[model samples]
Target: MEITDLTPAERRVWEAFPRGDGVDFREHPEDSSVDGAGWGPERTVRAEVLRALLLGAGRAEEGRVAGLKIKGARIVGSLDLRYAVVDHAIRLRDCWFERKPLMYGAQLKALVLGYSTLPGLTAATVRVDVVLRLSCCRITGPVRLQGAKLSALFLQGAVIGPTAGEESDEPPLQLNHVEVGTDIIANDLTVHGQLRLNGATVGGQVSLDRARLLAPGGIALHAETLTVGTDLRAHRMEAHGMVNLTGSRIPGQLNFAYAVFVNPDGVALRASSCAIGEMWLRNCPPVQGLVNLRRSQFDLLHVPAATWPEKIRIDGLSYRTLAPHLPAQERLPALEREESGYLPYAYEQLAGAYRTAGDEAAARTVQLAKLRRHRRTLPRHGRAWGLLQDVTVGYGFRPLRAAGWLLALLLVGSVAYGLHAPRPLKAGEAPDFNAVFYTIDLMLPIIGFGQESAYAPAGWYQWLSYLLIVTGWVLATTTAAGVSRSLQRQ
Candidate 1:
């Protein structure tokens, strides 16, 4: 089929085609020459109106329909022409009207609708692999790309919807940003990507599900400065390179569920200055990359672990969603690689996680490891002395220390009484309370042996010293109680 300029008879044929659904015009070879005289006036008008209806219906023929002007055709309808082959890149620039255009469920080679002025456009299930550039176009609807596949899609600098209005210049119900691409850049655009919105304003969900970015140096999808009113979901998106989102403000959740980021040099989600509602990065295992959220703000859930190996330096943050599933040993590499100052902090969280999981032995082991690391920096004597005290006096452990202190005080008092004060009646001998009383007489020796004066010299002096020691102990115990309570609560 060859496409020639529209003649008066050809125009009549186009007009004769039904304007309703399930109607299509046959494909003919498109004349590359830009000759308007061939189609004339009457034929041009008929072709223009018919072309609008066909494109709107997704019923446009594959071959070519060139040299025919079809601008500002207000055909309120939906399009669904899938697997249509176009030899040349199609152009639909600056075409306006009220309707939901369905380009989804279609397979095109190349599209060039750049600088096109459109209002209320919706395309879902569309598949284009070559190049689809709609740069700087004004669209007033949810330009949805639900389940679409594009090689290089460039909607750069395009205005998705109007400001100060909820009703999109087009219509609502935009599907998610579901595309597999070599280079897909939709930066600085103001409109939600995931859903068909009511207004042209940027407010809805954005999903980049199962999308693969094949680029190496930079990211596959670049959506910076996107002011979302709802969630920005990127589930199962595999990027072979860095995914840089320098500055984006989201009013709702920023979800990266099960996303694989393969950037070792750079980060996966570098949202340095974003203001998110709730950030969810669930089930994202440790990657050899950074997800730096430096200076970013999140309202609710903050799963810092889910965003692991990501250099997320949050200055002013409200992170209530911090749940660690992995133990401290597993997260050390990530902490070191990211050079996070919160390494110890993350370790503390891991300890808590183990405790919460009812793994007391594991928790104790982790804590002991931390203590050993801290002890390694101390002097040898101090470390040895501390370790000795840890076993003997139980160090800071209250339950064992309490019993140990009681027994130590008893032994000291008993020995002091025997050596310093010998009983006169016994004649060169002193009643050994420790042996006679044994365990049953433990309390009597501890509290009373030093309380009374003995016949041996230095009796009053020893009694006074003992009283002072008891008083000193009471005061020390009180102070220790206060310190223990304070630390335990914190």
Candidate 2:
């Protein structure tokens, strides 16, 4: 590890470090042996020595490292003690890198570590400058950069591996309270590990906020107490495992808004103890997820004047899309006045789950409650009451004409009975014995005596007049009652 016994190539790498101040990394083609292949056991020491020397020279103009490579030597021995000062942003593009506890506690400027594979590299407590872009990097061991200050940290298209085993002492990627600058766009990044940002404070907008974590994958992003400035836009970020952020504080709107989670049977976003300015999980299409904002508060009153998606899938519930601005009177009326109460379906599902587990009383209570609400919210006087009345009036009251027909029939019957009178008597024939007997017999029956009528009684036409009067009143009363009830039903 001494400088006196340095080989020719090692000597050149060492000499360049001290002499290459303010050097442009792009100009030095020999700075990074990006295409360097396998290294021999004997040559690795020389190569590593040169690597350390290059790092010691510190950064050139734009924080670029010159001749940075290891060319695969099994990574049994420690390498690269000198923390390469990246004057320009460091680029590890196309480097056949193999790190084993190397760069363990190094300080450097912003890193553009991408298109490279570093298996066991550990940057435990390194303080990085603005913008740590790690696109398409395959990281195996736990990359713990706790207390690292990353301004525009992006990890787009990177593949991160998980911890070794249960007893493995590797800490999760702890960027705990690491302050980020403007945007943290990490789209299409896959982390097969426990990505923890327990208390990270991103000063600006945080945008992981599309990274995917496959399952039975271990712990996903746990930004529990992370703080954000503006929007946390994580749209369509799929995680088969859990993404627990129970106590995160988002000052602006949390826009997972439309992010779809795969397995919501697990904890999706547990913001139970978090504080959000506004929440926009409006139309997420998760098959089964739980956005447990149980005790969270939404202080941001103005949740963008845009129309929100009505329906969402939560814990096996498929909520149909609805207008967020629906008037209280307009939304499908639920018995509960509180908006939270509108989640009866979800409640029922939970209750059913409980009930299926042998909690009979609880299950019955939930089902009964739903039934009561359904009945309570039913519209008054049936659905088509008003329409039926309108149609009745539009048809010109044919009901009234039907009543007239019944009345006319009764009047005709009375007229026919009178016209078929039993007697047609001569004007002066009363002195005849036979005629007198017949007239007295008819008179007895008409006067209520128990005898057959041989002739009709006097004033029978007057009786018909009275029948007409009664029929008129009956028809009028019935028509009035039907019309009154129809109008009053409104």
Best of the candidates, lDDT? 2
Give the alpha carbon lDDT tens digit for every residue of 418-452 in model 2: 45543334434323223323322332222322222
Worst 10-residue lDDT window for candidate 2 reads 301-310
- Deviation (Å) of 249 in candidate 2: 1.9
TM-score of each: 0.46, 0.54
lDDT of each: 0.49, 0.51
lDDT: worst 10-residue window of model 1: 19-28
Error of 2 at 5 (Å): 4.7
Model 2 RMSD to the real structure? Answer: 15.7
Residue 236, model 2: lDDT of 70
Q: Which ranges of candidate 2 are over 4 A from the true structure?
A: 1-12, 15-47, 54-77, 80-90, 101-105, 162-172, 215-218, 299-490
